[model samples]
Target: MPNVVLLLAALAFAGCDVFESSEPVAFTRIALPARPVLVNGTTVVRGDYQLSAFTRSVNDSLISVPTIDFDRQTVLGVFYGGSFHAGCRGNVETIEGIRLAGDALIVEVGPLPDLGPCRAIVYPSDMVVVNARATSVRFVGAVPQ
Candidate 1:
């Protein structure tokens, strides 16, 4: 039994790839729905996702969230209307860690700035915020931006 354990450990250690990557991972922008929120099976942006920032500038509070969209279901808009980046979070910053593995789209979102200084905006047109990064996102395809 102990010999088997030692053999497994040795194999795992030998499989480590120290030279796997040498470049910074870029989180490519994903194509999402104009109304991409999915509550149960219906599309609706609720909870923390129900947010808005008036100006699409760095001065605005960062909308740091994981986005989930339908590949064939959510109607893809040719033009994206809003802008929210880590630059907007002032002292704090956010990064939507969008990744592509095989056909999966992974998003690892950092923390967001406090909503105190943020001037509240309504949903729909004003709701041009990024989907706050959830625990995990299961997706496919890629749109580098």
Candidate 2:
């Protein structure tokens, strides 16, 4: 009877909302053909022209980042700026969470996987379409080095 009561208590506490922010922002990850070389750190792009210019900075082959409706959505780009092994690919795991706090969007980046035996150098980058209008973004729990 005691074991059952303890189990029930644990489950009940687990179900309770632990995160401070309850309001979540909708987001979708987008793929890029090559890693961006110019833009580094967190970037908030609200206009088509800004996004277009960012894509042009990539030195790799001509690529097309997913066309987003700037009026309805915004793009958030997170780049590590550091080079990693070729096996370390970004976006392999889903983004953890995005929540709204006041007018700022708080983004949580999940861990990066370790693929064995990497010889070539590569840059880790990720882009997501957030379905909310925010003036700024705060990144938490960034990609593991």
Any runs in candidate 2 off by more than 4 Å, and if so which?
A: 1-20, 35-40, 60-64, 86-91, 143-145
lDDT of each candidate versus the true structure:
0.31, 0.69
Per-residue lDDT of candidate 1, residues 1-145 (tens digit): 9999999999888877532432223432332333312111111233333323211322344434345442221111111123332221222223334444333334333444352445432111112222232333332222212
Q: How close is candidate 2 to the true structure, as a TM-score?
A: 0.69
Best by TM-score: 2
If scored against the real structure, what TM-score would every candidate get? 0.27, 0.69
Candidate 2, 26-142: lDDT as tens digits: 888877665545434666789987777777666544544566778778887777545544654544443578888877788888765563356555556677888888787788886
Residue 54 in candidate 2, Cα distance off native in Å: 0.5
